[model samples]
Target: MDPLGDRVNRNGTPTVSDPSPGSEGGLALSGTRTLLLTTFTHVLVDGYGIGLSVLLALLFGRNGRFALVGLILSAYTLATAFAEPLWGRFSDATGRRGAVVGWGLVFASASFCAFGFVSPEGPWAGPLLILFALAAGAGAGTYHSVATALVNEVTSRENRGLVQGINNAGGSVGRTLFPLALAELAVVLGSPGWAVLPFAGAGVLLGLATVSAFPLASPRTFRAGTASPSPDGPMDRRFLARMVALSFLRTAFFVTAAGFLPTYLVAVRGLDERAMGTVMTLVMSTGILAQPLGGSLSDRLDRGRLLAGLLAGSGAAFAGSLLMEGLWSSVALLGISMFMVLMTFPLLFALMGDVVPGNRLGAATGLVTGAGGLAATLTQATVGVLAQRTSPVLVLLGLSALGVLSGWMAMGLRAPRSPGGRRALGS
Candidate 1:
């Protein structure tokens, strides 16, 4: 009569089995409820992350120092990248994924709010800004690995891609909405710090809500010791190496292109702040549809091929954008690129779940995402310095080249084997 209908072996110990589609231990909060909660949290947290760009733009103004901007951006990105594996390891060890998600959001939100209050011109602003950025990044870093691991714990393999896609789309929603919301707040409040108050407050509330919902969403069966190893066997190191490399390249491209897109719009294309925010919103909005479509396709088609094609398509679209003369036309092309780029995230997450053991999922995810973060940090810093010497457009074009290379590299990923089959790679 164990909850979850867990079967017992001859020794009377519970035998490991996948959580049945949605319910974990017959808990009130089904997989659907957990998905919903995680998705909402994703919106707020990712919104804050993307919204930082808008805040940075506001604080620095149109003609501000690109070099300094890059450094500060790198600080956050680097810390986030560095913290991912640590947080992932912690989640795996403690069986407290909910605590990680809830507290991380609260800590990041508080730090971000504090960041808004510091004057850019103040004598201590440089040190203070970097410190806050590090704090916020570390807190934000705790999110994806744990939340995703939580989602996958309850979802069946058949639905994992779709569920992850929906979860990722929530991030897209945040990325899309936050920029405009923050921009509007900036216009109304006229103080960058005060503008962040509303969003930060929302994040704090969401974090508390997550903490309260933990017991219902996470049952003991889903905890570390209760779960068993994946039948897929130990992960292939070579395949993991390939994935990490792919993640690095894609992230570097994304960070370079999207990170500087707003600046490119304002400085290179001559758009006003409001207009830039609108275009940014439009670009990210594409992900809402693209992610689900990509996820659904991955379930039926070859994930490796789909991923390669998407990366190539994204790269082609981005390259095409550079050739366009008119601003709107270029924006249209860039929007398509953004669409395809966003689609790849859930695919990557789903791919990891397919091979990695249940208990090690968090750590593996952390490593993959952490690699991407590291790439982003380096790319952001490098491009920031290079932007001073050349146009942001050229810098973006160079980054777009990395996408094509990533696509080529993605072609090497073996399809994930079915459960009870031999491992997917190095077989």
Candidate 2:
């Protein structure tokens, strides 16, 4: 209980909001629309995120330029790692999710346009490049964290698993198609000199999504102070231990897939960005189909067991990918391996919904994402150096081991149910 207007009568208190009953169909629809728009935005933004590196290659055209491309590739995740928990807590504390999201769009949109000023030969280019990285990352970080929180805020536990599939699928859809589209756009726009228009369009889409999310109904704040502990004893300690380690292994594998695998193709086999993007599109698009399959599989199958089985399969696929004798065969095997890699994400998100308490869901998700991002950043640099000295097969071998480790770790997790088969954790 809280006093009205800070009573000074020898007492201290805080006001709490009353729980709102009933769902707003409009808000749910609006959230759905926002997510759909977000998918489109993600494709373009991630297009800018990853494609910017290839574009920069055109600008610099130097061997050391790979370092610049690497920075561009890594910066988004690094920024998101630092910001997710902060934004999650902020959204939790204030309940101004829409406002936070709207403002995030403003920052992201401006940063996109501002990124055009980062020229290699200009006097201020070096510092401007750093600023572009910092701003793009910070803004993108805020938008994504808040958006994820909002998805949970509106969806019921019954549907969280399905929606997790949907969200990740949305992202896959974006990344899958966006690169091909942007590659064409880059050509039409004559990038490396003037490429601000595509980023500007992405910024506008973000703005539209943010504005349409207004009029969202406020959520019924859960009883955080009084909710009973999970029946699965020592929830926080056990779940955190399971999730953090799994997140690290999961992210480490993805970094290896995206960074080392591509570099291996280029260094050992000599393929360029266009060729790599073609393969990336196929791999990502498969997940648009595979994630729903994974989520449905999670419902019917033992999630932990399924994860283990998939990893063993995935590791074998990647290992075989390394041994391919020709370029065409290499691409085929890598595509299959990458598809296997993509299938894991929805299951992971669904598993989070299974294990974490609904009350503290945002924080828990943020922590998992942050841990993964940290691992990814470290893995990319390590694999890059590893590729320089040893054979590419060695890095693939290491990732194969990581996949096996991830499966073992997945085997350690058991999603328990409450007395009524209701997941107290599922958001």
**Number of clashes recorded per candidate:** 1, 0
Name the regions of candidate 2 deviating beyond 4 angstroms. 1-49, 52-68, 109-130, 143-145, 192-196, 215-218, 221-235, 260-267, 389-393, 421-427
Candidate 1 whole-model C-alpha lDDT, 0 to 1? 0.78
Flag regions of model 1 displaced more than 4 Å.
Answer: 1-29, 215-232, 419-427
lDDT per model vs. reference: 0.78, 0.59
> Could you tell me which residue pairs clash in candidate 2?
none
Residue-level lDDT of model 1, residues 272-319, one tens digit each, is: 778878988999889889888788788777788889999988998998
RMSD of each: 4.5, 6.4
Q: lDDT per residue, candidate 2, 41-63, as tens digits?
A: 55454444544444444444334
lDDT of 2: 0.59
* Candidate 2 to truth, TM: 0.78
